[model samples]
Target: MEYIHGRTGDQILGSTSIPAERKGVYQYMATAIQKLLRIPIPPELPPPPPPSALNNDVFRLVMFLDTEAPRIYQNADQLELHLNTIFITAHDICFTELLYLHMGSIYEQLKGLSNEPMVFCYGDIHPGNFIINDDGHITIIDFSETSILPSSFARYAIVSTSKLSRG
Candidate 1:
């Protein structure tokens, strides 16, 4: 399948013209996500949530939005600057608020994690490779795209609906 530049000037394989193969991949991905979403989060995966950690998910989301905006924008150059500004400013605000909430302990816990970060992610979940069936439920088509990292997982949960920047 040949890929070309999209209206956004991004090189995306807009139409693969290979529905059968793509459909198979999609079916597999949808089933996986469905299973993962239903499974209870494993106990040893992430650190237990502190009372203040309720907002951590939101914090992760904003970061994900910042990371993804550049990819989805039609005018990447123009949107990049704006997204960077928003990310920085939002992060500043986020830290400012979080610092006051007995975050010292939290930071300590996360500090060691910097060297070996752990994130949970539903890696691919992009719109182009996904479809909504007659039942109006969305299905993911590619499992090759999903991944988990501590930072990224935080971002996804926050920006769960954000589109991946098409490439």
Candidate 2:
């Protein structure tokens, strides 16, 4: 892995409590991920990787990062704390509920598009997975969770509730 000399979106958001600034960072992240999802999947490639493969890798990495991770969140409270620390640092309280609802909606939408075209997706697009370099450009770091999914699903994954402005 190449060394990245930069701060994570997590660290930058954590160091500030301003909602606008945080949202700006999230917008930047959304833009970067959208660009990534636009790359067309090669037609000659083999069958898409199974979702289980990505899940297993993520599980193993999380376990390696925190040995007690499995036992650490035994209930909703602990789970909430853990999520707050790692994932929802900048969003408001309602954002989590909205995120879940949006995810459910996207899942239902994608179900109807199983026969639609596919795209290359990052699979995981959280703040921690992105880095802000000294030049202010955002770089996506991890690709272990990358996969080919329905184009609509990939677009929803990045923009979530926001409408993407087309020029």
Q: What is the C-alpha lDDT of each candidate?
A: 0.37, 0.52
Q: Give the candidate number with the greatest lDDT.
A: 2
Candidate 1 — what's its lDDT?
Answer: 0.37
Relative to the unseen true structure, what is the Cα RMSD of model 2?
Answer: 11.4
| TM-score of each model, paired residue for residue | 0.29, 0.53
lDDT of 2 by residue, 91-156 (tens): 433334333443463122112233446566564567788898778788888776565544543554
Q: Per-residue error at 160 for model 1, in Å? A: 11
CA RMSD of all predictions: 14.3, 11.4
Stretches of candidate 1 above 4 Å error?
1-38, 43-120, 151-167
lDDT of 1 by residue, 1-167 (tens): 34322221011224455667455445644564556555443334456531111222222133333533223332223333443455355544333322222225323212222232334345555446545443434444444433333332334432333332422
Off by over 4 Å in 2: 46-114, 155-167
